[model samples]
Target chain A: MRAAAQVFDEYGLAGSSISKIMTRAGTTQGAMYFHFKSKENLARAVINEQAADLSLPERPEGLAQLIGLTFFLAREMQSNVLFRAGVTLAVEQGQVGLRDFSPYDMWADLFRGELEAARSKGELQDDVDVAEVAQLLVAAYTGSQVMSNLLTGPDRADLPERIGRMWRYVLPGIAQPDRLAELREVAERTGPAA
Target chain B: MRAAAQVFDEYGLAGSSISKIMTRAGTTQGAMYFHFKSKENLARAVINEQAADLSLPERPEGLAQLIGLTFFLAREMQSNVLFRAGVTLAVEQGQVGLRDFSPYDMWADLFRGELEAARSKGELQDDVDVAEVAQLLVAAYTGSQVMSNLLTGPDRADLPERIGRMWRYVLPGIAQPDRLAELREVAERTGPAA
Candidate 1:
């Protein structure tokens, strides 16, 4: 999966080949095929197992958790080839003959859970729809990483800073008025690169 | 340029070749090479000339102009191959030998101009930094397009809607308190698919 993700990330779908993945993995065709069946199948496995390396910090639940999760993702995307590969594959899936929105959907669902908890804790404004905010966060984070990746390529050192900047612009619209100051504080303290 | 953008958009940078672009353009390799020198040069030209097709609407200045421009971009990316190609090439620059952040920087500069105008007109909150907000918009828009392109593929039918959704979550934080209601109204009326 890691090798497939790396190949897919580096070359995109149409440019990647089974031989390249095998060489990257240092495995024989028969052995690789035995596990993944085909190139597309290997790609699928990579996409499906993308989140295996992600682990959010043991922070308090609610908005802080969401903030920490975003920061963690930015950091991971910088250092973790598998995570970055999964994102690249998920974004470029159409070129690879795969129809999948599950990656974004799964992320939205995860954000929703965190937002729902925040709502229950009165961290979110009454009018702020958890699902909508979740989608917004996913979209913003996804785009930020893509831009950072494009600008800096493999280093990805600027990703955390970009995402940290994102939360600053977005969090104000969703957090409760009274809780706004604290939430902004949380965002700043946990901000990208911090 | 059109042919190169289309090929790049469909296959990404690594997957694209001079012959493919020439075939798409209905031109000969010698003719293409005479002008472009190499595939990388052609790709660079495509990235550099991306904004040629773009024309912002003659609308009122300030935040409304910014909003309209975002909507306009979504519409263009849906219909304009050159614009899409430029964006694709810029985002996937890692595959090509060229290193360019000019595309994004240009976008940020454009957004900053509108934001500066908005601030001058008192449409923005005093606490807002035009540069920071501009970067945020560029990042959010970049991310939104990637996700929309991912979920909907080349059709990109849902792009305007996704961007509209993004505005809903982002604008309140930047608009002046007195102008918030009007900004929200404009967002809904100009919203994607609306």
Candidate 2:
């Protein structure tokens, strides 16, 4: 999987091939297929695997943390080209061309769960329009990776901070006015979204 | 040039060699070189050529139109996979990454220009952040395209309405309370988010 991540980092999801995956993994096609059914299936497993690493506790903090956590998780995954390429390519396919739910539907499910949970906890606006907010955040963060990765290449120092700022900056507009106050309270308690 | 667009679309930026371009354009490399100095210059010219066809007015009402124009141009160039390829390659090479500045940038530039003009016209709040707002719009709209494109594939219908609703829904937040009246007045006279 790490090898797969490396290959994806170099060529991208739309650009990856089974042969390359096999060669880089130091395994044969049969060995690779034994663990995963198809290319798309393998890609999905890799994506969900990373999502697993990104999951957080049900108990939460301010709106910024909730939002920033999501963005940070995404930026962190940027280092894993496997996950990054999968989500980005999925985003490009799903948002621009058609309703691509094949792989992303699962990611969206997890994301939606987190978002709705936040809303119910008063971490989000009551009328926050969960669907639209999720859509925008996903787009912004994903687009950020695309733009920044392409323009600045993949350097992490600026990414998490920039990603955090993007969430902080945009969250105010989408969340209830009081949510900002909640963010400060939470940040003071925990250093994450600070 | 249209033939060149077709060739680049089919083969992608790096994939399409000079021989392929000449073959598709039905001209020898000699004739092609006469017009474009190098592959980069030729790619640059193709960008300019394709850009003119996708250009839109710099009006606020035209923002959504501009967004729509880019998606349409991209879709038209969809079969031409090289649409963002050369541009990304250029950016990777430390250029503006504006190689032929995808219609998206023009949309962003137009959004910035009209927004600043609106601010100048006192149609916006003096405290309003023009660049941030513009960046937000660019991120959202372009982000939507990325999401729909990479995730779902080629969804066009949902795009226009989605973007329209997006621009309309967010306009109020970016405008000052005093300018709210002008915005409503403008939106009614021109269009939502005008």
Best by lDDT: 1
lDDT of 1 by residue, B32-89 (tens): 9889877788788888888888886444378988888899888888888888888866
lDDT of 1 by residue, A118-154 (tens): 8889888788888878877888887777777767776
lDDT of 2 by residue, A38-109 (tens): 656655555555454444646544354555566556456656555665554444321112234545455455
Here, model 1's chain A TM-score works out at 0.92
What does each candidate score in C-alpha RMSD? Answer: 2.6, 5.7
> Could you tell me the TM-score of chain B in model 1?
0.93
Task: Name model 1 segments beyond 4 Å from true.
Answer: A6-17, A56-60, B9-16, B57-60
Identify the runs in model 2 with alpha carbons over 4 angstroms from their true place: A11-20, A33-52, A57-65, A88-104, A121-127, A161-165, A181-194, B7-24, B28-50, B58-108, B125-127, B150-155, B181-194
Instruction: Return the clash pairs for model 1, or none.
Output: A143-B143
